[model samples]
Target: MSSIHPLSMASPYIRIAHDFHTEENMRIGPTRIVDHALHYFKEGDGVYTVGNRPTTIKAGSLFLIRPGVPFSFSASPGTRFHMYNLHFDLIEQEDSAAITFPYPKQGEPQRVPLPCCLPDEQEMPVSGLPSSVPLVETATYEQLFFRILQRFGQPNTIALLQSKSAMLELLALLLRQTENQHASSTSDGTYETHLSHAVAFIQSRLHEPISLDDIAKAAQMSKSYLLKCFRNIYRLSPIKFVMKQRIERAKCELLYTSKPIKTIAGETGFDSIHSFYHTFQREVGTSPGAYRALAHSTALQQEEPE
Candidate 1:
């Protein structure tokens, strides 16, 4: 299995460099990268070989290439590949380490810090991720990439900070997606196969309206059976899973974009601004505008020179 590093809890300095490329018959590396990379293919097809594992790459595929992983890729003949790529380093301070928080009472909230790095036994299943994983082309994902491109175009201290925050959000999204994929693949028997299909369907149509019947049909199962399988694997009904995905996309937009709340609502498939407001408040415990403001303020403060 490939090694994996967890994101740091402290204010790890993240540096981002990115580009968009369109080309035919291009070949790159059997080399190792010094920093982590996230590559999004917007068009065409290719092959990415990591170590001895070769994974097919196509449009809408996202590849997470880790540092020190030997990988290489080339576009198929007569086809042009359009791709967006990001290279970033999560630089933790030498003195930074794992931290813990304790509550005095049982009823009070506990706010333990996440580990700065994962132990070997706790590393995520990197074999499940391979070199390329397909992702839904949600509005929020596209917006994040575009915004990263925009920030790179106009370099500044604040833009650099915003770009890092956006990159971190993208990494977090990929991690969640990878975990879900791993879970579905590792389940038993036809349960695994059916759940994988259902997950792919939901991810591919995250921005569009998806009914339980549609998901059931996609998985080639009856609605009731699909519900049971989905709940057993995910502990949530298909509809609720869809809502959770929409909320996640909304949070990304809230953090990264300056788009109006109504526009973000429409893009994320909320029926109305009121519904978006209420859902955001219920799920996040804050309004969308306030959340964005706080995120921006915190990012700027952290990125400020010490």
Candidate 2:
């Protein structure tokens, strides 16, 4: 699993939430869903079919089904099953809570959601998230699932808010798992050597226009492979990584030097003063001059004896 930075969105609006303890010989749809869904198998002996892919359900199998995907559930011969099922919208709409989906139908066509990704300005390079995550410690996840189910099974505003908060926490936990996996992958000697080379190249070229090709060449890999490496390790593209390095260098120059804003901008490889100001404001939440002034004020206050 690759690392994924929390992308732009508020807490999800949960639509349907339930804990299902199945009866004997049970089988359910080939249902096409219109909202995102999470089916956490707490203790199940079953097979979950999503699109054309099918996976066996274990004690801690989590199926993350995006909107418009066809899925079905079947019990493993004579075995009863138990799962926590949740349907939600990635972002809330005014009428989200009022909407309800139709019953599952067979042979429902699949519909794809707009791609979710990081690197705000870039086109979506990430195609799809993992369909299933086999959880290691089931207790923590069970607690979250219980909280979400409990909160959403209410009739008040506070309950709604609490459910949404718990949903976000669950998503964060899943992302942290993937991030830890990616971190371990990066610890491999070859990946570390290439990543170090790539970082050194970016550090050296913070004052020059560094391109994706340049970074790939430095890392001795193809551009596509380099992108995969960066996405896995840093959860962003190589060019975005370079831009970040440039901004960091600019911040250091602003705080410690008397250079003019334009000089600093040019030295940090920004195309123009306007571009520098825009990127600086977006990344640092302040204009270059304002940040420098604030840093200067802090330094002066610190230098004064208490």
Candidate 3:
């Protein structure tokens, strides 16, 4: 699995202002929300439309509604909608002028960004948050939602902190689940499961000059079969994939460390500094020194006072 940056150590002041479990046959407007919400359906069914996408919300379903997105909920004709709902915010400090919150009424759809890693399409509509409203169904997840509902009944700091911790845990689980789903969607089940071993082997040995035979043996498949599966799944030869991984590692070293260009090249498995310079320019559209300079300047600018 790819590594995601950890959340900031700054304590996010998350408050659960309202909580309820209701079984009502009703329809809510196509209005936008100003705060993030988590809804876990326990009974009945409904249709929720977020932006332009319509999703079926049935019993055992969980929905994360991002702020500023227009959404509506309508119960099925004969069934009552019963769900546990919680509305909350990740409060920002007063001095944090760089942070902006979304207000749809003011014609701004962007909300305060959350410190998470997610794909572009999955990002919050206009908030720049790392994740969008995702719907998931699982018994274990349902139990977590139930625990949050129970915690809401106790109005105390301990309970509030507990609820916040639980919500963060849930968010992490959802993000990981979504990542796994995306990985699976890119290939067939057999290829997805088997190719993972090869990918891991390559990633782990990126500092070494690994060959196709090595990867095939690690993946427990013949070279020809491995090549076919890899091409079908990743559209790249195993060697190309290894090269890409090496480049990516080199980029990280360049941006995050003050290591010399020659040292970085050697660490990333390049045969010579000349080859590293050529490959880095070809892959990144910049020389190693230029990329490092640009990254440092950007970092410094971001750290500057407003």
Please give the lDDT score at residue 15 for candidate 1. 37
Among these predicted structures, which one has the highest lDDT?
Answer: 2
Please report the TM-score between candidate 2 and the true structure.
Answer: 0.51
Q: lDDT values of the candidates?
A: 0.66, 0.71, 0.63
Clashes of each: 0, 0, 3
In model 3, where do residues sit more than 4 Å from their true spots?
Answer: 1-24, 91-137, 153-156, 187-306
lDDT of 2 at 225: 88
TM-score winner, 1 or 2: 1
Candidate 1 Cα RMSD after full superposition onto the native fold (Å): 11.3
Best by TM-score: 1
Encode model 1's per-residue lDDT on 1-306: one tens digit a residue.
934354534233343445457667888878765445667777779888877778888767777676556788889997778877765545543422221121123464432332133221124454234456546434446667755655553435776676667766765565555565565564455766777688778877776789998999999999998887767656789998888778877877777668898998988778899999998899889998898888677656654555
lDDT tens digits, residue span 206-289, model 2 = 788888888999999899988987887667798987887678677767765799999999998998999999999999899999
> What is the TM-score of candidate 3?
0.46
**Model 2 lDDT, residue 290, Cα:** 97
Could you give candidate 3's per-residue lDDT for residues 1-306 as a string of tens digits?
944433333244344433345556778768765566666666778887777778887765666666566778888886676666655554434522333332345555444554322223434322222323333324335445544554553546666576667666665656554544354444456655567678767766767789999999888888998888767655678888788778877876776578999999998889899999999999889999998898667445544444
